[model samples]
Target: MDVLLVEDDKWLGQAIEIGLTERDFQITWVRSGAAAIGELQRQEYQLLILDLGLPDIDGQRVLQSVRRKQLALPVMILTARDETDQVVQALDSGADDYVTKPFDLNELAARLRALYRRRGGHASAEIQVGSLRLNVNSHEVWVADDPVRLSRREFDLLQLLVSQQRRVFSREQLERQLHHDETPLESNALEVHIHNLRKKLKHKDWIETIRGIGYRFSCD
Candidate 1:
C-alpha cells in the first residue's frame, strides 16, 4: 500500500522513510504540508504519516481539508506536541492515532499495520484464508491445523498475499512489498516463494494463478 509521509525535519524524514521502506511499505516523503495536500488532491494513499510541525502549513489544516473532501483516509500524526489539549484536538480533527516524538520504527510499523487492518475490514490480529491461518501479532502461520515454520521473508510474503484474498498482485507489486532497498529480488523471487508455499501447503487448492496477471488466493 502507498503511504504519504509528511515530515519537515530532513534527517528524521530520511530515517523514517528508510525504516518504513525496510518494512515493505511504499512511502512518498514530502517536507511541507502544501506538497502533501497537493499530492492527496491528485493521487490516492492507504495511510498518512503526518507531522504537526510542517513548514508551510499546519498538519491539522491538511487533515481538515482532506475530511472536507469526504475522503476518510486513515491518518496517524507524529509530533512532539503531546499535551492533553493538543492530543484531544487532533483526534477530534480526524487523526486515527498519534505517536509522540522519539518513537520506535517497529512500533510505528505495527501501528500502521493495525490501522490498515481495522480500515480494511479485518480488525483482528489473526487473519485466515482457506485452510491457512496467520497471527499478525505473534508472527505465526498455520497450515491445515499444523504449525508451519517459515523464514521471515517467506512469512512476510505470505502475509501480504493472504491478507487480501482473491486479489491479483503483479510481480512488481510483490517485489515492492517484499524488497528492501536495492536488495535484488532475482526477478523470479515471487515464483520461488509461491512454489515453496504451494509445496508446503500440499493442498490441492490454496492459491490460484492468473494466466497473465498475477496470483490470487482461492476464493472458492
Candidate 2:
C-alpha cells in the first residue's frame, strides 16, 4: 500500500522507510510539513505517518487541516511526546493511532496492518479469494488448504491484485507500487514477478493479462 511518511529526521526517516518497504509498503517520504501537505494533495496514500515535531508547521496543525479538508485516510502519529493529553488530543483530531518514539518497528507494522484492515472494513486478518486465502498480518498464503510459500514481492503482487479483484493495474502503476522511487526497475522485472506468481500459484487463468493494457485478477 502507498504510505506518506512525514518526518524530518533524516536517519530515522530512512530507517523507517526501508523497514516499511521491505514489508511491501510503497512510501513517499517528505521532510517538512509543507511538502507533506503538497504530496497529500497531489497523490493518494493508504496511510500517513506524521511526526508532531515538524520543521515547517506543527504536526497537530497538519492533522487538523487534513480533517478540515475531509481527507479520510488513516493517520498515525509518530512522535516523541508520550503525554496522556497529547495522545488524547491527537485522537480527537482524527488521528487513528499514536506511537511514541523509541518504539518497536514490529509493533508499528502490526498497528498499521490493523488500521488498514479496519479501514477496508475487514474484521479479521485473513482475506480470501476463490480457493486462495492470505493472512495479511502473517504474510502467509494458502491454496486449497495447502500452504504456499511466496517471495516478498510475489506475495505483494498477488495481494494487490487479489484484494481488488477485477480492477486492472497498468505496468507503471504496479512498478511504482512494488518499487521505491530511487530504485531502477528492469524492463522485465514486473513480468518476471508475474510469471513467478503464476507459476507458484499453479493457476494459469487466475491472473488475466490484457493486451496493451494491464493485468487483472480473474473472478471467473
lDDT of 1 by residue, 114-198 (tens): 8988776768888887678899888898877899877767788788888777788877777777786577888688888888877
Which pairs, if any, clash in model 1? none
Off by over 4 Å in 2: 124-220
lDDT top scorer: 2
Off by over 4 Å in 1: 125-220
| Candidate 2 lDDT, 1-220, residue by residue in tens | 8999999999999999999998888889999999988898898788999999999999999999888774678899999999999999999999999999999888889999889877757667788988999998899999888898998778888888988889999988888767855668789989999998888888979989988988988755
Model 2: colliding residue pairs:
none
TM-score of every prediction relative to native: 0.57, 0.56
Each model's lDDT comes to: 0.86, 0.89
